[model samples]
Target: MVDSLEDTIEEERLELMVSPTGGDPTLRIAHFLKPSVTSIDGPISNLPLDAHSFEDTIAKPNIWASKVAFNGWRNPQKQWKHWVHHMHSLHQSTWKEAGIHEAVMNSTFEIPRNDNLIFAFAEKWCCETRTFVFPWGEATITLEDMMVLGGYSVLGDSVSSSLKNGELEQIHEKLIQAHLQVTRSRARKADQSTWIAKFVDSGSEIEHEAFLALWLSRFVVPASSAKIVAKVVFPIAVRLSRGIKVALAPAVLARIYRDLSLLKDITVKMKTLNGNEDDDNDVRVTSLAPLQLVQTWIWERFPTLRPNPHLIENDAPRMARWDKRKKVNSENVRQAINSASEHFLWRPYAMAANGYLPCKLYKEEAEWMPVGSGLDEEVSSLARCVRVSELVGLDCTEQYLPHRVAMQFGFDQDLPGHVPRGEQTRKIAWENYTRPIGDTVLYIPSRLFEADVTKRYLDWWKRSIFGGHNVTKTAREQRSSSESLKKTVLHISNEKKADNDLLVPPGFRPKCNMVEVSFDDDDEDKQTLAKLVRKIPTESEKSLSRENGKPSLDPQVQSPSSSSTADNGTVGKDKCHVKPVDNSIRRKLAMEDSEKEAESGTFVHDSVSISNKAESSSLDACETPGLDLEARIGKLEYAVAFLKAAKFGHRSD
Candidate 1:
């Protein structure tokens, strides 16, 4: 069945390529349909040659000395919550129809930045290929990352597409006028704060439009300034407000690529200067891209570097997991990245969710699907994510290469074939960027399974220059240190357990020294357990009383034959005698006490004060002769029952 699907997909791909009006006439299909290479004898073009050089640059103490900034834009104000709620309530169906409900809802969440982590990752990014070159393998922020983490859509109209009618233009003009009216200035740019204060909950027709403008300006493609560029973000906001779907993932990925390239270039320049430049001439490079996505990507892939993220419910945006910030220094982050080969998660999202349902694009069975203009939205989206193409953003155009990291897409990795990047291919053409232009045929795999690499790819990876030699040495050192730490912890725990065991008597010792008890809020069982535990004598108290020459607390050691007990007439004074009992008798007594307590609705408080008082009163009884031993034995049995009941709850007979 799978073979038939593959054949059908291949036929469709060929038909589409040969059709006169289907694909790009300037480009040839053979360029993309080339198979993976088995081996390479020389250096591959565009691949990073020296991994250690880049690693050293990032590890330097003065890497941040060149005024690098990755600060994110200001979040939406608290007062804007009302406007968001209103828009959600009023246009819930429209947002969903446009496939941006999750994006809009997710925009409200604040994703705190970890500048150190982002800087560490950006240092390793290869600008030519748009992937972070690690010793383990190649990995990059793909369209899937943008879609799943940033809540952006992979399938929609091009972000560069302009409105053909004058209605949207008029609405745009009204928004500008409103901004001008609020600011009372002739300046073209509108202050973000002023715009939100004037239009949020104003009950005007353009309230929704204004709210979307704020979202785009603050979140989608944020600027360094606090002002909103009406000419840039207003049109996209108007389209989104009118239920028009915009392909945001590509633009987002493009901007990230651009920022990463910029950051990498500046770092390289700083490295070239070797810290010899004057401080007065330092140039500050502030990134305007949404770098929250970059930080979230790092958190998802590298487990050791990130904080413990909050677990969200199923179907929630995955980005919500990292809503808090963690403090990290440059030294630790550099060390973690250096030894991240063994810990990098190639397919982080392949793990089964707690209660997740499979979306339309993901399935349990692997099959080949043809994706293009006429295909399903999910299929088309998947194709766009897995294909190699150019991503066009508002300000930049960057290359997208999914083949170098095929393992990320659930495909078996092979030697990556060279992808030609001619001038025409790099052009920022909206029509080329909007559709799934590369590899019309793609293999979709089950979400739960991760396909391993081919033997040839593995062999090539071992010999690849991009794989750093220092990575193995650093990883081995880290592993050895962690193992020694674990052994030290285990040794301490063992000594503590041995010390605890010496204090407990043989028969009364607990089965497990570490007792884990959990109780619900305000539960009756919890109160009952607490009362019983308070009554039992501690090991220290028992040892102290024994040292003071007081009568032993163990009921078995005390003689039952006493004159006071004989007066009760419970047992004949001459017939009754002390007898030794096994551990089974104590266990049976506890079970009987639990049953009685449950049936009669009586609670027994075996408190330390009560026991001390009883011992004091019975001091003479221990010396008395001709007393009934059986009558006194019953009292000791009751005391033992409380101890057992406190430690272990009711047991089945």
Candidate 2:
């Protein structure tokens, strides 16, 4: 049979009734169609119309009316003072419209006797348009006032016995002031902060001291109940002091502890209501649980064990996010690499050409490259883990699954190298700087890494003003290298000369007259000759004839045949038996010879010259067989000294 849509649906009947057990009691409010203003049937008591004034101008301004009106407004230095002034004006206007100022001054409302009455009073205030404009919620008592209510109300009997008359009012006033401080200041936006922060942030030192005084005001509570008072007001005091720095009196601390204890009890009560203890058989019977009717509860519990559907679905979008991040990182790394290269190499080289060393400048620039590169060490480590996972394949351990899964969707690692771009650039620049510059074997200094006007100024200060060392490290190194190169070049030149010597035939003497050639009179050549003469022996030698059975080389004593053989190179090979003598004896001998020549006065110069030449030839021929080559060289040097004396000594005389 074909049925209509309405016929297929089942309808249930609904009715209004009182609340179930543990729920709020129903309020029996009496609604009036056209009741007179004097009629009193609801929570609000009958107000004396004659005493109450509905006029907006009912209250008169105090002596400091203008100052009070513009209190925060005039303080241009205070943040959000103007906004506070505007809000105050709105509040004043609302108070005037609702006649709340007159009500507060002239009327007194009774505290509800029970929780139901209290709830009803609160609801009436909340729903009423006149009370809706009041701050700190529509209830007559504010959240701050709840502390006092804990002491006065039935719910707070345990702590209430501890509080005395007027103590609750004083606590409420202090709490309201603290709360108002946060709400009035710009710091009000951070309302979640502690009370100390809010209060201290609200005003200056003077205001802080004033609030501290309020906290110190003595309460009427007894000594025994002081502990209970402390627990009840502890949180309020903390809120008051949130942003404020003040010396809290012992009394205030005690009250704060009392308030806190009450709060703890209240919390326990709330938890008891919502916990398993409250899940009684009544709830089970009233509320239907279709899941309980299931034949297999085991299969039903499987859904709870399964992973969250949202989490599984999130993988795709999560990968896409990572892909986007990778692309950005890659771009950043590329830019950093380029910047680092410029900072490391090109910039520094340019600075060097300008005669500036900017190591610090390059260092500062290099430091920035890593920040923009976007690949922190964490991501690089993750990439390593991913690579390890890939190599290990599906058999890889579960620990690295996150990194592997992240890279599974063909997403490149795009991770930076272990060495930072800046460091790499510095390393490269330093390497190139240490090595030879271009084709030349000269190295550029690493100190000359970067350049700027500041570096130039510092260099100038270091050089001109301070009179510091002129040579830099690079310059010193170059100078030492050049000196080494010069020595090497000289050695190579000597090697060429030695090679030339190999072409000369042995025993083939070139008959060059050693004594006949005139010496150059050039100043440099004379200096060179003087140096060589100074190096030759200046001390006198002993006579060989003293130790030998032969006569010495004296023109007056020697036979012509013996002198001829001696002059001929034969005696040059024989060792002379001699003892050491002084230069004075040799000089005296030369003078005597010259005097004798002068005395003879018959061309003695010619004979002396011939004798001198013959002596030189024999000295050269005497190889000094008994002595080493050094002794023979010494003998030749002695002969040269004697010749100089015979020729120059007589002329001076």
Candidate 3:
């Protein structure tokens, strides 16, 4: 009777879940119906394996000349803060207009490179899946990571969208010429120093565009040279100058994936060579990707491997959590990483102290939503991240597989289905990369769900790891080697602790105290200039004050309450300030203002139309004042007539 009942329960469970081999796209609930059963089996894979090979690559006496040195971007100087200060208010207004203020703000915070930590983590990176496989499970840096850590927007026009044979193209050409004229070079490119000197405070109409161009070239997709590539960056910079948003996160992620593959290939080759080659013939690899992002990802997910980070301020970007320099001993990184399974943070952002706030992408319940279903931008962005699609970059493309790591997105895991990589799939992925596919629905899982794998998935994982392999022999050998290395490291640590009582304990790493550093007279001058700029009033604010028949109040003398009310919405008598007006209300007000302008023979494009080109083409064609008024009026009349026809046709039906 008990066996019969167990069989009945299994049948019911099978009925509720779709087979992994089935063609259905809808996600099943079977993965979440039961709790995960821990497998008693040993390490799942060779991952978190010995890191001696990677450590030895960097352990050479001339470590600075090693290939791993090129893993991260060149650190910018403290003086770079002056450039940020110069463009502070302009950047705020421009990025807000472009609908990328959140991303832009996050990009400004500097994350100091921890070379030892990065190298240690890179050893475990699997190039095929673009993930770091560990003993517990697989984890990867995804589009979500780019959005959170680097402040790149997932919802925007493709990076390949360029100005083509339009007024925009003319504008782009003129901006390119400005760079050439500033540098006085035959080449179209300009060096960073020359670009900054020419455009920082030039007050020219193209100053903002030039600044963005420099930023993209240096920070976003930098090459080995110091010169900014006008052809690659200028078009996007021009679009941004016109307040157009570009999907930057996908492209950034593609570059990271490509570089990581290259880094892995070179590292494998070096390991094979085993120091047999001469010094002159040694292979030196350089990774152009922004590896600081990879380091930050590891720091966020691995508690044991993380160094002490800086305190984060309210409303600041999460990247600000690592703004301080951290001191780490390279020697113990392998041991820490090996034992990180118990200390790993599966969902770090869910914790309030991690400095992540609930955004629009978060949902309370799991549901299927059609991509590009005229949904909110945040919802659409989240859909793009979760879907199995191809990520297009400037020079490369990569496949994204969120289904395999469903747990990372706060969903329970089952056995992941096969991902189709045929030519037809690639074509479809490219053509509809930023648009909605016909009748296709994307799974938007809830963050509130418990992230765990089903019992069947655990069993399958164990079999895959232990089956067809001599697990007994491999486990024994690995255990023996790992223990020997640990004893050696522990003995060395003890000797060092005895000699100098300052050595940290075996499993406990203390935080480094904040230290103050003195600056030069040039730094003081930059600070003075920044303060003076803050005191000056913007032209619009000055005009508004003059119209109101009152002198503008000095910013420094303004009361906290008045400034707070003006910056945010009006404050309440209660402790918490009143919520700011919703986006819907703001859009309604903007439409009303546009209608008012329209009566005066001016047609202002709405934000929605500006973002969607198909909706804006008619308005764009009528932009020139030289066009006949009757022609412009006829276009509007035709649109109104078409809408009336559609309404009457619907009513008749």
Candidate 4:
């Protein structure tokens, strides 16, 4: 017992030395930071001794040196730990000076109007952990936890009031239902063949739930707000990447665009309606990265040809570096401009005790946001330097500059091959897309790839499908059968507009009219008709004779007054004869006789026509009573016309 007690005491002593003041082990692990804590060169030394002296701290600015100090700094882990501790101390001092805690505790108290106060409040509040003590136990909470716990109290009352109360759960439910509907409906429609369909089917339940939750959160408080969407959605989007390739569906994308745009416009209107004279719109001032804002939309509507995961993972780190670099460059430009304006450096800091940086720093020219620029020379040449606060005017222009620029000059309006921007993309959507037949592929132009930087987008997309690139082979064949080959091919050309010079051949259908002749009343006419039918070769017989290498011969062309001749040219006479027919019947036969007469007088060019005429004449002279040749001829004409009508009259009917 004694030995154990001694060991415990020794351990407690070591713990005290390692982490003094009962602070977190992580924050307390700063040896080198201790020396700089009271150094005259340090930022804290510049602060007034009295923490509550508002005039000096609020008026002055301070650049919070990065924990890393420099890109080339050694032992980044240790250095960052120390930096966090120093920044926290600075944050607490500022909060004390500004009485922020006192303001939050009171419902009626107004926050400081200074931008620095708000900025520091938000930054420090986010980074620090709050200890909430209850009667039974104590709980450590992060900013997110505080957001849920405090709700309207933590987020401004205006935001809470503006949002529809109790709509969050309803929205989540809607999103879940929509996701399930998309998965099942798409799977059934495409036979579970699409990549999205298969992913939903094969993915674990946890992954699917995580995706739904992450996507639904986009409509929630912090995520919905453009200021923090990058910080919130980016990580979630990356986490859900394995199961879901696209960030959001097309419908969801449209909703997000409309919502964010409306929110920005509505904020000012709301303030005016509430009788607040503070007409300054803060929404437009914050720089929301366009690519990050509508990431899902870009992935769904304008998918890249290839996905480089390694490069994508590097974005956060690169953004961090760029942000730091831009801040330093902007400050340098500000200093030069201030010198030209003949203002003394009252306090040499980027941020005051409050969170806001002077607006002039942000208003520096786009060119000035880089290193090695002769800012001193440029500032000297300027006729005048505007006041720092006027820089807020530039914020309105910065709100959606990237998107505005892209729409006006990018592929949102005009596209290659003279095709419109959204048409080609919309065609290939899951609900409406139809695969083309026989190795035909969609060709999207390089100009249309403004949103996606994939070199071979089509090829990569084809490979991403479940059945490789040829998943839609059966669908293509079905489409080909339903539509004519010529029409189908032309439809593709017109829709894609990949080549304006493409020519579409006209479609055609062969015309076939079935001939029908009625038997005359006379027995002789009936007999002649039967004889003619027997003389004509059947279709099969004709084909068989051709296959046997036999030449086609015309049927016997014997007139009523002449004898019939065989294929070998031997004459064969028939004893059936008839008296002269009635005038009406003769008139019906007149056209047939006239044709024969014309053939005999004029050299008969067509032997087939001559044979038909001779057969008709024989039928006219058949030995039978009351044969109505006129009626038979009229019926034949009517039958041919009706056949043509039946073949092509469905459209009008």
Q: Tell me the whole-model lDDT of each prediction, alpha carbons only.
A: 0.56, 0.22, 0.52, 0.22
Best by TM-score: 1
Query: Sorted on TM-score, highest at the top, how do the candidates line up?
Result: 1, 3, 4, 2
Q: What TM-score quantifies how close candidate 1 is to the native fold?
A: 0.62
TM-score of 2: 0.12
Q: After superposition, how far is residue 162 of candidate 3 from its true place, in Å?
A: 1.9
Backbone clashes, each candidate: 2, 33, 0, 13
Report the lDDT tens digits of candidate 3 across residue range 218-284: 7777666635544577888887777788878888888888877776665566566654446525667
How do the predictions measure up, each by TM-score?
Answer: 0.62, 0.12, 0.61, 0.18
Sliding window of 10 residues with minimal summed lDDT for model 1? 484-493
Model 4 misplaced stretches (Cα beyond 4 Å) = 1-252, 267-653
lDDT of candidate 4 at residue 601, scale 0 to 100: 42
Best model number under lDDT? 1
How many angstroms is residue 90 displaced in model 2 relative to the true structure, after the best TM-score fit?
Answer: 38
Candidate 1 deviant stretches above 4 angstroms: 1-35, 39-46, 50-54, 58-66, 71-73, 186-189, 224-226, 275-280, 325-330, 370-374, 424-428, 435-441, 466-653
Model 1 per-residue lDDT tens digits across residues 240-283: 88888888888888988888888777667666666445742565
Model 2 per-residue lDDT at 223: 25
Worst 10 residues of 2 by lDDT: 390-399
